[model samples]
Target chain A: MSGFIICFLIGLGGSLVYLLRRKKSVKEISLFVTFSLLGFIVWLSIFLGYKVSPDRFFGWIIDSIGL
Target chain B: MENARISGWQFFLLSLNFIVGTAFFVRPGSIIAVSKQDGWIVPLIAGIFAVLIACLWLTLASRNPGLSIVQICTKVAGKYFGGFIALLYIWFFIQLAGWVTRNLGDFMKTILMPRTPISVFHLMFLIVVCYAVIKGVETIARTIEFLAPLVVLIVVVIYLFTLSEWKWERFEPMFQVSTWQLIKDSLPVIGFPYMEAVTLMMLVPYVKSRVKTGLLLGITVATLLISGIVFVTIGVLGVTRTSHFAYPLYIIVQELQIAEFIEHVESTIVIVWLIWIFIKLCISYHCAVTGICQLFRVSDRTWIAIPLVLFISGIAILTHENIVDNIAVDTRYIFQYTSLYGIVLPVLLLFLTWIRRFRKGESGGSA
Candidate 1:
């Protein structure tokens, strides 16, 4: 959660700066920030939380596919 | 951002260097672990398949000349949808950069500096790569062109020294793994260092001439060269021994003894492999920075490169608990991401372009 907040703040701050500059596709900066924050959240959950296992990730996929 | 353009050969060497990067350091052991004696064939098939996929990427680039893949995506799809796709690719490039950096740092820690922290190596590496990315892709390409021959020469010399030690009996008990198993083993080879050439889509537009054929030939030659390296690893170490070691290529290099006088040449080989890894990391960093710059309509990436490097370095350090988990994730899960970017996205882009009837313009089309 700390990782997610830090990354989210970073992304939000960066995108806000760009928004102030009124760059082309200024609206897209929000999208970029959202995605960046989401990516950080996922990485944190996997690497920091140790919640996801590679083997289990694949196994679940295989099971779903009935492979 | 920079308007620098490279010739076909330099571009070929750059692509070659990228394709044969840190992959050769570790892929052999994983493949051998799966296919046993038939590990040699995995690279052969993967290399050939990579050629076909690269040809697709080149065609897409040629059709939409002077535009990076991100730009091409925006042109083909609308701004919103295309920008979303481009952002995904940006993440892929950044993630790949992190992985390669971690691989290099881990390797140096294992072989050379057991006491030194891995973060020190990662920091040193990113500092150099940050300079390369800022100096622009042309500088990196020239370096690769100069270093490519030396890399090939060292590989050849190592292989020659180890040739006499190969035992034919090692190849016996072949075909032990089923065809399905062989196919499974080959997926990493295809999905990684090979199909990962799709990252070249970010580069193809910058080549001055012969974009399609040059990239195709480059990938083909690099793939073949890597296939030979895999074969040599299997021949010298055989399947079981190769699978046992983490750095199989380094072990193969350790076998080199010229008249028992010139020893410890494995250090030299490791240095050369580090150069290869450096070039790969630089290219990935360049892609990520350039993609971000393009995405935000930023005129220059100069300001953001350092922060981006820090972010990636953090990810590299924090992502894996250890090399064992790293390798497990790399071998098993990397295909899911690579297939999406390498195979699915490009095919979708090509299909969309055909449907929309987009054609290359007079000024920007291939020369």
Candidate 2:
């Protein structure tokens, strides 16, 4: 969890630096932050505590599609 | 940008090399595991599906002449939505690069270097791939065009030597599996090696002319080559034995014996396979870096190559517990994930683009 948190913070800071450096729009910054958080949360869920079984996730999709 | 443009043959070779990448060595075991003796049929069916998907992708790509898929997404959808989609593709490309890196590392550790850790191999591969990415796509394309023929020649020689051992009787009771089973198993083949040409969407803009025709031909040639490989594997090893081995093609090459001498040519085959894998890694890494540059409005992407290589190599090393887990994850879940991005996303994008264009045409006609 600590590792993920640090990685997320680093990414967030990097995004800000990029936005400033490129002179991008506020909307772009917001989009970046939103997507970064979204990705980080999912990644955290996968890597943080109990590992999510990729098989189960995929099996559910296969069953949902009736395949 | 003008200097970056590649000739049509270079474009064709790039696509061909990308399509017949690491998957050639890694896929046969899984395909045979599913389709049994009829595993060769999987590539045939997947080839047709790939051609159709390629045609649709080409149409969408040609509609926006100079833009890669990332730019096309931004144009078709508004900025935020397109940015989100483009990011997904960038992640996908980077992840694929990592996966291929890990695969090569695993193969080397298993077969050649038992004592060396896999990360060492990954780092070495990533360094070369980073160098290629920095050299730009034109260099990468020309590199593949110049070397692909020699690689093909080596593969042909390997095939000829192995032909003496092929048992036609081994293919007995073909298509024993039910139609549903065949189709279900074929999905992985389609989603993986075939639809993976979708990555070419990011490279199509670099081609000088007849972009659609170039893509179709490249894909066709790749599909044919893949089909030939699967067929040879099944014929030489038989379906059961082929599926039983971890690396069927590698094992088959190891088993090759010509007349009396000229045996144990597996090392030569490995060299050719490594070259193919290297080209594959470069294209994936290039696409990821280029996509990120376009996404972030970065004028020069080469400066970020080392950082990206570190991130990718770290992920590749840390992703799965081991090679067994890696293969399991790939065979079980990859098709589902790939379907979403490779098939569903492109189909939806094409449909939306068509509708938008039709409405504009209607409005103009009314005016």
Candidate 3:
């Protein structure tokens, strides 16, 4: 939750700054920011200590259908 | 030809995102499972040995200042043969996307939507990734730069969040894996995630500036440093447990229960991994589509994205019968061919261009 807040603040700050002088397309900025938030979210979860495996039955189903 | 496309920072950071994904979440855990708790040695080996491969990429990019890897291949290898090589690379990238999709889908389904059909999940991912591809590499690079800092901050916060999980003695007896085995294992680790930066060769000519080379290299190195943080993860979680998870990093976040009241934070992790895989898939899919378009001499590549997405979805389905097979098979191939195509071939290209340049002198001009 705290990480999410921080990400929002940072993103807001970025949005404000970009809103000032730059004229890059909204689509471009939105796409970039979306990816940025995504990256942050990913790192946040990993840092929080996520576990990964593909051996359990669910992992098996996922790999079979999607991998 | 003269368009100053992606900035050096943008290209480097985007390329770095590739390294930062599923590998960071799972590598240290995976290595420790295979080689035991001594996995802290993997990142160092990855960092130190990867320079050679990176330098080879620089050589290739420097030779043809304005040509993409595909165009350069055409000039160097000639029309028919070069097109064939490019097609092979396209195939490699499609396979790469398939592997990423499976890894991501397996993680998401197991952790986020326990009852949802994995195919539905993959189709959703394919839609987002294909849309991003249609937007072009500039969109991708810009996306990465803006995301890199947030990613760092988020991970740092999470690190602090899970600081209690950091068991000190887990890292004891670090050298137990033997130098040979550590180095050997690290090769595959680096090859798949780190060394694969060589794929950025395709984007070199597209950089906004060549002077940003050093900065680009820095971004890439730091990306691996983020991977080094995984060693901290393995130390905290215990390698034996982490390897057992398909989405180890997801589980890591799921473990973060603040004050014991705010628990089950897996949704945040799921969203993030989904985005990472989406971006990875987008970039690889873009590369594949563009590579194929160049091979077939198609005018506009955007039209091919949908059909290609369908084909990729098919390949994703066929990649494995189960998560166990997918990981075992995909990891092995990613380790092997990612190196061959990503590092070795580019190095070989550099040598070939070097010799040809030497023979032709300034007239050839490394082109």
Candidate 4:
């Protein structure tokens, strides 16, 4: 769980950096950061496996995506 | 303002480092997997592919002596259209930097600090690379030139250390793999590490001399470096036993047991490999940011380095945590564009320039 939290916050921090730093338009930046973060989430979720509660739900979404 | 000279040996050595760093670390054993005893042929074939692309790069450089790739596109394609191509390339270079950056951090996790968060490693790498980029391309090139000789020296030492166990028979039956299988296996070999030399085209305009630079050095130097790399893995582990390890080269170094005391030499290999990977990533990252800044007509690329570094750090984090297939991406997307930019696109531009010149001659003659 701690590993999971750490990965998530690091990821969130990156997206925040993207939002705050780049000069691209908001819509353009939104697409970039969201896709980027979402992809990370998918990889992390699959890596951790379908554990209890919401962890299992995220894992299910990742499995459905089929890499 | 660019008057420094990187020796022929330095260029040769950089080619060696650039080509051998990642693939030789990963691919040699796979070649062994395919050809079994004939894996020796893969580097030769891959070397030829790299040379051909480099020939095109030189041709393009010669056409526009003082112009960078972005400048060439603008001159050849007209303003807006060329800007788009340059933009795509900037994105490509950025993505390439991101990929290699992530891989370097992964290496740290695998070999050194297994428990350290990957994000921190990436952040440090990005920061260091940004400092180099801000210092400018000439500095980076000179630094690489200086580092290149050291890499060659260490590689020589590694080869020497692995000498007691080499097997001559492992490289026989060189064409044993089916042609299709050989070519398919060779894709990652050509495209990933070697093809990235297309990025060097961006540096050519700044070179102090192009007269002595030849395709042989480009082709054969990296050829020897990669062969040294491949053969080191094979010589240390024997070809048959190396296929299963992901970082076979690292494993090969770990096997160096000397006089019962110098048993663990992996640290030496680790340091050398880290410098090699850092230079490779820094080269790609600088090209990407410089390309963007150049396209926007910025007066200096220095100001852009900080945010660009931050962006690449984010990008490294975003790449799939399990990015083992990065080799495949290199085979597919990177190879295609590199071949296009380094070989096909440049050839097309040169041909167009020639044709236009010929037509003008004819018209001028008629008049």
Winner by lDDT? 2
The alpha-carbon root-mean-square deviation between model 1 and the true structure, to one decimal in Å, is: 5.4
Q: Pick the candidate with the highest TM-score.
A: 2
Q: Give one digit per residue, the lDDT tens place, for model 4 in B229-282.
A: 676666567666777766777887788777668888888877787787777777
TM-score of each prediction = 0.84, 0.85, 0.78, 0.78
What value does the lDDT take at residue B111 in candidate 4? 76
TM-score, prediction 2: 0.85
Q: List where candidate 1 sits over 4 angstroms from the true fold.
A: A1-67, B175-180, B358-367
Question: How would you encode candidate 2's per-residue C-alpha lDDT over B1-367 as one tens digit per residue?
Answer: 3248888888888888888887788888888877878888777777788888887787788676788888888788769988888888887887778778888988999889989987789878898888989889988988898888889998899888889888888888876988777777777777777776778888877878877777788788887888788889988998878878778999999999877887898998898889888988888889887887788776555555656656676667655767688777767777777876787777777777887799899999999
Per-residue CA lDDT of model 3 for B1-367, tens digit only, reads: 2233777667666666766666666565566667667776677677666666676667677787877677777767778876666766776777778767877767767656779877677778887888877788888777777766766677667777888788878776667777898888786677667665555666666776752464356535754565566676676787778777665666778878888799887676665656567667777887776776565555445445654555566556556667677557545545555666776667666776777777789666767
Q: Candidate 2, DockQ to 2 decimals?
A: 0.13
* Cα shift from native, residue B8, model 1 (Å): 0.6
Clashing pairs in 4: none
Cα lDDT, model 4, residue B200? 64
Q: What lDDT tens digits, residue by residue, belong to model 3 across residues A1-67? A: 5875686577557764764456655544453444345435443443465423222333455446553
Give the poorly placed runs of model 3, Cα more than 4 Å off.
A1-67, B1-4, B210-226, B330-333, B362-367
Q: State residue B279's C-alpha deviation in candidate 3, in Å.
A: 2.0
Quote the lDDT for B207 in model 1.
Answer: 88
lDDT to native, each model = 0.77, 0.79, 0.65, 0.66
* Model 4 regions lying over 4 Å from their true place: A1-67, B1-13, B169-175, B178-181, B211-216, B328-334, B355-367
What is the TM-score of chain A, computed separately for every candidate?
0.52, 0.61, 0.53, 0.42
